[model samples]
Target: MAAPIDLELKKAFSELQVKMIDTQQKVKLADLQIDQLTRVQKHAKLTHTEITTLPDNTRLYEGVGRMFILQSKEEINNQLMDKQKTADEKIKELEQKKVYLERSVKEAEDNIREMLLSRRAQ
Candidate 1:
């Protein structure tokens, strides 16, 4: 009886270890994505500032694949704003995912503790 219980506990522990590792990897990925998004947002802000300083008569040609489309300053500003907004949203989503993953890890740890306590009581 004790041998069977011990094997079961060992299996459960290994499974939990695997889950913890997977969660850690996911958290690291989320952190990396957040960092990239922040860098993108910063670059977009710099571009916006430079564009704002340019003269109205200066022609801005936005490259779209094989062609460059002539665009107004307002249009460029709007594009930058959109980029910034999208980056912000993606960062927020990654942060939320990190939080959720952390919460799940905590719960798994608590469950393991309870299981250990119950086994000891038995």
Candidate 2:
């Protein structure tokens, strides 16, 4: 007893559901990336602050994938500054992605609602 338009609407709704799920997943992944980058940025800032308080000649061991290499205070400060900058950039990128995904999700939901309303009125 369903009209052709109803069937079409249902199909569209299903597709939207799939899209919404995918978008939600993307948002979640972006949020996780943002969180990770934020932590890295904070850690880098802390390291920079603490390292500056140390004597200039103090030796520091830089960790490289489970191994530590000897480095000077200036070298460590430079590395930390670079890391902080990279983390800031990545966090900004992920935040933008998250905002876009959120907007898409909202739009999809609105379209689904409209379709359902139209079908009901038919």
Candidate 3:
């Protein structure tokens, strides 16, 4: 009877340990994703600045060429802006998830500690 109870406790603890590890990995991945998104956002802003700073005639050929280039840049800028917004939103979501995972890990640790203390008291 005691052996079975000990085995069950060990299994539960092992499962909790795995979950804690998985949560830590997820948090790390989220951090990397946030960093990547930040870099992409910066790059987009820089490209937008370069496009806006181009001289009137120097950046594009006159006539139809000018209109085409201007239109292309506008479309690309819009797309980049959209991507940045999406990345920002994802980063925010990941941050929230990371916080929740951290809390869960803390709670799990506390539970394990409490269980051990109670076992010792018994």
Candidate 4:
């Protein structure tokens, strides 16, 4: 009700707004990362399946910056497995981060609501 309390409440509300925005941005980034990792994992699995069905003498190529170089089937398979593993790990991490960010955003919203309610009750 007092001037100081009112000013403090407004400041706190503003700070929470900023925090919520930042957390939301992080959530969006994490979602994008999760989607990318999912795509990579799917591609890796598909490539691995294709590799298995290919003939022994089949030629394989690895593309690098506008160039394609010959690669052994075994080498490509290993690389694909490694890539899939990395993507899986990154996806897990991003999912956890997304959950945390969602929680943070919810808490901030709740705090903002409480502040508004208190201001109205005064």
* Candidate 4 Cα misplacement greater than 4 A, ranges: 109-122
RMSD of 2: 2.0
Instruction: Report the poorest 10 consecutive residues by lDDT, candidate 3.
Output: 57-66
C-alpha lDDT of candidate 2 relative to the true structure: 0.87
Candidate 1 lDDT, tens digit per residue, 11-83?
8789889989999999999999999999999999999999999999889988899999999999999999999
TM-score of each: 0.91, 0.85, 0.74, 0.83
Candidate 2 structure quality by residue, lDDT tens digits, 25-59: 89888888888889989999998999999888788
Candidate 4 lDDT at 83 equals 95
Higher-scoring candidate on TM-score, 1 or 4: 1
Poorest stretch of ten by lDDT in candidate 4 = 1-10
Tell me the deviation in Å of residue 94 in model 4.
0.7
Q: How accurate is candidate 1 locally (lDDT)?
A: 0.93
Per-residue lDDT, model 1, residue 87, is 100
Question: Residues 39-61, candidate 4, lDDT per residue (tens digit)?
Answer: 99999999999998999799999
Better of 3 and 4 by TM-score: 4
User: CA shift at 7, candidate 2, in angstroms?
Assistant: 0.9
